[model samples]
Target: MRTVAARTTALAAVVTAIGLLPWLSGKDPALSVLRARSAEQEATEEALTAIRDDLGLGSGPVALLGRWADGVVHGDLGVSWVSGTDVLPSVISGLGVSLGLMGASLAVALLLAAALSTATLVRGARGTLRGGAATGGAPAAMLASVPEFLLATVLLIALGVWLGWLPTSGWQGPSSLVLPALAMGVPAGGLLGRLVDDALPAVFGERWVGLWRTSGVTSRRIAFAALRRAVPAIVPQFGLVAVGLTGGAVAVETVFAVPGIGRAALGAAKAQDLPMIQGAVLVLLVLGLTAGALAHLVRVRLLGPGLRDAALALPSPPRMRAGRVARAVPVVLAGVLLVVIGWGLLRDPFTVEATARLAAPSWAHPMGTDGLGRDVLARLGHGAASTVGVALAVCLISYLFALTIGFLPAFSAGVADIANALPPVIAGILVAAVLGPGTVGASVAVALISWPPLAAHASALVQETRAAGFLTAQQAIGSTPRRILTRHILPAVAGPVARHAVLRLPGIALALASLGFLGLGAQPPAPEWGLLLDESRAYVERAPWAALAPAAALALLAGFAVSLSAWAGAGPRGAAAPAKAVS
Candidate 1:
């Protein structure tokens, strides 16, 4: 209770400090207006004025400062950059789109991830082939590699233009979001799969799981139970991903022609709209931090402390139950899905030679080639491969790097708190500007985005695991810190670390995809997803397929990765609490 109170007080202080910033910055509306007038007059005479005189106009700097201070005290976030506009409406509207997209993407990602992991980890259920795990895991790698714009473009072409199945773009209604959601959700689902896979193996090894098997509890029931237990830990990983989604909104919205805050931010960025950018960033920061705090609070409530020991203490049954194979039907089904999808992509198909040639459906063009005269089937294969390859490489490499660096400051609670306060996007933009954008820029962006979760998870894991008795016993035995960490600690926390990485996958995928869409990734003629969308803008009216196809593909791939990773992170019911509170 005391700790909670203290933390609450600290948060209040942060709020208060943020509130006082305008006043402290010497905002005076009357003086500001006077100065603005003087500057404008002088600039007109000198003919060198470049700044927007009308941006954030108010009373002089001092009065403006006072009102800002007063507003902060009264809980107002203030007006926006444009005249006669309240900032809150824009913030709220943008937030709604972002939240809706994230929610849909998250749901798809989790469901797919759960199904994929269950199939991959549970041995020999239905048609459970030897390489099921590899095939199932392949989606994450593929989806992560592709950018959202690319996926959306492919979807636009294949589903919208060719089939006329859905609307090509715009945010006036839900139909517009289908492709975007798919492009976003697929990759996320794939990423979540890793966590679910790793965590389940440990849960399956638990004594209670064995005991339950002996008790005649069905394998399906056991797996479901395990997921329930896993939720507390899994939720935080998703929360972090949610934060990343907010940062990624700009590109996805832009690609789909959705009028979300992301589009607004892009407009602001283009105009060098400083106040607008600051406002957008501030909103994003607040949202991210709020989500982080909420996740932390929930984890603390669910797992509390001493969860690791309880999980370890669960007893293994003497007589293991049979029918484990029978209960693994779901797992086998997922493996089939992976195989079918892979086979469809790899199987040889007919080709077309003439560009811009439209022909009746025939064996020669199974998927009916696109405007570029390339076989749609062939393009699909390459596109899927490219998308998944990039997603996996980026997720694995970026997460690994982040995990290592994040561990450094996590041990010190005070430092971790301070580090957590800083948002990664600010750093990412600065880095992007300096690097001037490319694969190198994407790498730096991923590294920056990947760091916070790595630090958060590593620190929390260390803190929680350190409290375990085995580690205490080792300490008493004079075990070296390095050995204890590498051998005892890391090994024990592998499940959680894997889960963290899985959960973090969606955000990383988004960041990579967004960068690509923004022309900061996979340069032209490379068939990059985002680049495809960027190029398709010219033909949105006449040939919406060019943009929609890549955009949809990107969204679907991302959604899949997020779902898979989330599923992997889920704990089984009756499974013990996570080694750490996964804040």
Candidate 2:
């Protein structure tokens, strides 16, 4: 009861702080607008003349405030700042589109993650390659390192241009959701994969599972039942990932030119349209808070106390008997393939004319030109570099920040929990607003926003790992906590951290690309995948390939990242205590 009381107090305090932000930010603009009104009133003779003339309401400022207050209190949401239409209608319509997109994307991502996790878990002890190499976590981490725009860009081009299926940009029908949904789902899917990868192994290794199997429970039944039990553990991570998806939605909305709140906010920010900005932010804040609360409720209800414990347990797989050479060959081949692909793509951009014209079905400009007429091949090549580069950069930067934030609490548990509570979204928005828009701004935003979960995971890991035998032994031998952590704990925790990074990478990439595509990041002539798609906006009807190229690129890159993350690392250790080892 006391703990609940304390937690409630903390939540209230956080809410108060968040509510205060707009008022503080509004002061400058309010003062400027009001001061101008004062001057106008002085210049004129009427009591409310200046207010009416300047604000277009023919009413006093106090009257406007009264109306706003009444509407807000009653949940009316008031009128649109631009069209003077009912704000509730606008919000409803826009939310419908946005929610539809979000809902579909979430569904697809969850499904894909579940499937991949099931596949990996079913692979079992024979899963080991040469040197008893760990699998899923490594790929998940790698994929998490890549960005979303790259996936979207690559897929858009391949599907729209090569396959003649799915429009590159803009909503034509239900199909319009496909590209954007893919963009959103790819990253979410990757994160889900990591969650499942972490969860399933523990389920496989349970001693009770073998006992159940001996008692006539089929292997499939054991796996399914264990998975059912693990669902509660997965919910909390899903909540964390959902936060990222919400932030990334702004970019996604802009890329497809969808009439969602995110795009509205982007327009408002660019125009410095105060009312619109305020309205959009209010909606987002409400939505975010609601989602977060629901997620928390779900986590508590489903996971209970053992939720975190289950997540940290490691599974002991049955030993593999595959020949060292055979295992080494697949790993080596995979590594070589990655190296070659990375090297080639990095060396030069992909160009339609140079790389695809003769081979592809001929049309005007054959493989087609981007907004700048750069070879699609070259643009794609560079786009791949940029897409993957930014994704990797965001993943690394965000993870590092998370690590720092997470560890700061090691010396004081209270401080760590407080740090965890600090809102990353608020920090990100403030930083982006101050820095102005661009790749740098987006990078900074991603770094700021992506840190919280990373911090949460890191804090949990550190708290647990600090007590492990190796750390105690090192301390007994006179090693510093830092030294012990750096040597033993860091190595052990690295794989899980990498998985987190993978799960996050695609979302960061998508956010950055959406910013670029919306003209918030890279501008024209930069050949960015998102920017490239943006440029083709005018040609949507004449040469849709122009837009499709970049979109495809973004999608493909995101998909690959998801795939890689699923194939990569091991589950979290210590953060969640596992069931006893299965013999």
Q: Which candidate number has the best TM-score?
A: 2
Cα lDDT, model 1, residue 395: 63
Model 1 lDDT tens row, 192-301: 66445544444555567667877888767776776655555565555555554555455567667777766665554433333344455556656656766776667666
- Highest lDDT: which candidate? 2
Runs off by more than 4 Å, candidate 1: 1-42, 45-84, 120-135, 304-447, 450-513, 519-533, 540-583
Residue 488 in candidate 1 has what lDDT?
79
After superposing all C-alphas onto the true structure, candidate 1 shows an RMSD in angstroms of 10.4
Error of 2 at 388 (Å): 8.4
lDDT of each: 0.53, 0.56
